[model samples]
Target: MSTDGVGFGVPWQVSAFQLPAEAPGAAELVTRIRELRARILFDGGRRPDFRDGEDYVDDQELDFGAWHFVGRREADGPPVGYVRLSTPQTGRLFQSRAFLGEGPFEDLLTEEGLGTAETFEHSRLVVEHRARKLGLGVHLNAMAIAAARCLGAKAMIGTSGTADGQDLFHERFGFRPVPGTRRYVERYTEDVVLMLYRAARGAGEYTALVEQLEPVFSTITVTPERALGDLPRAHGRAGSSAVTIPAPGADRRMDAEVWRPVLFEPQRAEDRGELDALLASGQVREVCDTIEEQLRELVRSREPGRKLAGAELERAVGEQLAGVDPASYGVWAWYPWSGRLVHLLPREEFRLVRTDRNRGRIERPQQRELMARRVGVIGLSVGSSAALTFAMEGIGGAFKLADFDDLSLSNLNRLRAGVHHMGLNKCVISARQMLEIDPWLDIEIYPAGLTDENMPEFFSGGHGPIDLLVEECDTPYVKIAAREHARRLGIPVVMDANDRGLLDVERFDLEPERPLLHGILGETTSADLLDLTFDQIVDLILTMVDRERISPELAASIPQIGKTLSSWPQLASGVALGGALTAEAARRILLGQPRPSGRFYTDLELLTRADRSTVA
Candidate 1:
């Protein structure tokens, strides 16, 4: 028997056990193991016969092909902690005998065994009280796992007695609970928790967890203290102080500290200079008061955040600026009164309003009638700009948008939205902008692409189809689908394409046969030209069209450059003209006025030329 004492200068050791016949000192070691177990159970837990005379060493069935790891200290020259592994067939914890008549173990084991033939069972882990806090348990456990892997086990399974212990083991060692076993255990049973460890599976789970946690760590908090320094300062004489008032549309209730720095600060020197100029011009006080009046009227006029349109806005502005100089006041005259800044309005807004006022002005009755129309546009890339133009013109109408692509960084060059809108779906971003321009517009959205499959559903065919279809999708498939569908339903289709600074149009209603434009472009198939091997189709088109009618440079670039002018500025110009012409066509069609029905193209290049035929 062994009589090694704890904390008595014992040398700590870790080793694996082999069959006694393979080791010369096996007999003596077996005797020492028996003494160690007796002393551990008797002194540590007041329980004897813990092994039930099983002579674990003599149990060759358990030790012959299995591995046993023991942690020892020289002071006690005996095992202080140990973990054992055995094939599923030999381990008592997993054997059919240990679970016979106990519950559903037979069926579970049978199912798991079939599903995972490469897995083994771990059993017989015990630690003496002296070794409990010395890391011996963890050390022996790891060694047993390494041994199991060395023997080619792909997965390890084990059971834990307590929920807390099971949670700790799985949390630290990367184990997952086996599902669908709650009904198998008795009401008073110890609730055995089953776990498995697969190295590859563990690695994948670890990666996903890290990805989920990264966003949490990367979040930044913006505070008001940082915002105060960024507010625009008014310019003043050397001895005079400038008193700056919050602009009319500004939400004073919002804590200036939170959004002031990021949202109010001018990002460029020119912006600061402009703000100072406004202050030095002695118009700052009047502007601030005007802004206040505009804010009060806006609040009283409609629901908060709702945009104003048509007569409502004209009347609001008229009331706000009853006597200001329309010219010297600059474009920002409306900034102090409205929540929106003056420059935010499209340049066309001021031009259109002034021109209409000068000409035979549209009567209030006629304006109300025009606003009653509804228009649906597909492909927000260009369609959104068109929608904005129509809204600015006081064309009161229900507006619908359709597109599936999200706003990306590349869109900032031409899109009316800013960086905050990046990653949002285009339909939503555009719809919000439209509503901001004219809240009265009955806005609807389909955040999806219009395909041949869904075109019928998108256009009302049973009762009454949409009055017009504006196709702006750059894709050939969408263009063909939209054109063909609109033609069949007898709905006039007004579509636009951008080439350099020019806008190309194909009016189906003017000449019903003109819907054949899709055919002329060879848009029968869905394949994109971008995916083609060569520019044969484009070359053929350029050769077919009159040389004098198109730009010589553009003609030469077609086969080589294809359509690289699909940028935002080019597209925006096209959409703006398309919106203007489309609204004109709608007015002519509804008013029974004479209008051109065939293809018409407009470009800034044509305007620059002295010869009008260059526009053809």
Candidate 2:
């Protein structure tokens, strides 16, 4: 328990004191904290299993040697948050003796080789419901850790509820989940996991917060409206000024420069400086060693028509590897977006091995021809799947991805992205995914989407014009504008409506004067659609899609767009089929297979109707 008269000044105060505190106003502060905890944890029938009255009480609250860290709006205000630090010196600990039984807890300590005296327990963290988002919970937790470490503790342990992803939140702060030990607590009606935190394994954010708080605790007093000014802003609250995230390795913004993987060839002396700088920054989190497997496959690919014995294969591999520097044999690729360093075979051999499986159907010459072309994609929701399929199949060596919207929770239904990718520009997400598949690919991104300003550059930028374009945007103006540019550049365009797998291909290269959407728009120019109202745009889109031919489910749900449904619905199956259809059209067009400008439907509902198929 801390004896120091430490308390942060005005707007907010964070201070700790031993149980049965002697400081002025400490008893009232304890009463306020207890009231807050009961209101949050027991009110509204939250703890129905407790037959006792709404007054929640923990036996540890009366323990003498334990300490309580309290947070408030002002120096002597009602408590908004609370955390308890139970030291081993108290002769009574919460997690070891009570949470986990003494016998099993002793075995765990033996397995981990942890000394009781060097560890502390943090438990019973509670923040007012409305104040939880104000970062008071995080601040209280940090202060608990700071208090523990200040008292000569080396580790901390706690029990975390799993219902609201609290355990995952604790994991981000360096807590390790105890394997096979999760149990449900009836009082809270949620699974609880035991967690331990060692200083050496602390996350960067937690470590930084601890370091910042440790000095404040030692100083005995802090005088600031906001004590820890560097803490994260209150969630959902607008900041008064721009605030940069200060924790190392916490930045997830994938900009244009960082999206491209940096290649390092050891044989090239000029790459030394870049490699050294990357290492010095300590950003490389993973080093992948898969070159040996690639080399073995490379040896096998060179003699495709013959089978070699085990000894002969080894000898051939040895001959190919003779005098070859292991470090310089291939190339080292660094992905700044993911902090990964990978070793891969050189470009030619890598391509040969990668596409070796595509032999008979694609043929080596056709594969080479396909890989030489560049494809541009717009609107990366459904387009992301098409772009990735194109990458995996080696359909294009270079790609241009464009999208203005960032990923959201709703996009996960069809987009190839995770929850962590939310808020990232769709173009950057797609570019990073494609590059991960084939590091040799050349990709350019337009995070601003296809606008009137960058329309020309998107069509014919840098190393010449795109051979094909896959436009899948929903904006009426961009859709019409992109097609106008494609027609002018003589580039072919492909699109998937994602309903009934409706695929539209316009070979503007062949039919220079063909009307957009095969005359469906009947002279609706991009300029005319620019300033249209939302309702007008929807009407126009439905007209272009020929609403009569849309899927039954989609047609039925159209009337509920805003009243019940947030937006038009798309399924994974439909999005996947869209990718395949677009890829097939683009492949046939690029290979000069004479696919004319037309709208085609591979509708599964129509193809596999029960009335139509009775062969069995």
Best by lDDT: 2
Candidate 2 — which pairs collide?
Answer: none
Best by TM-score: 2
Which residue segments of model 1 deviate by more than 4 Å? 1-361, 461-464, 500-515, 518-553, 560-579, 610-616
Give residue 31's lDDT in candidate 1 (0 to 100): 46
Tens-place lDDT per residue, model 2, 57-176, is: 433443345776767655555555667788887535565456688887777777888888877887778765423333566677777887777888778878887644567667766877
TM-score of each: 0.40, 0.59
Model 2 misplaced stretches (Cα beyond 4 Å): 1-250, 254-257, 272-281, 611-615
Question: Which 10-residue window of candidate 2 scores lowest in summed lDDT?
Answer: 238-247
Candidate 1 per-residue lDDT, tens place, 300-395, comes to 343434566667666666664456533222233222212333322222333333224322445444555556666668888777776776666655
lDDT scores of the candidates, listed in order:
0.48, 0.72
Cα deviation at 460, candidate 2, in Å, is 1.5
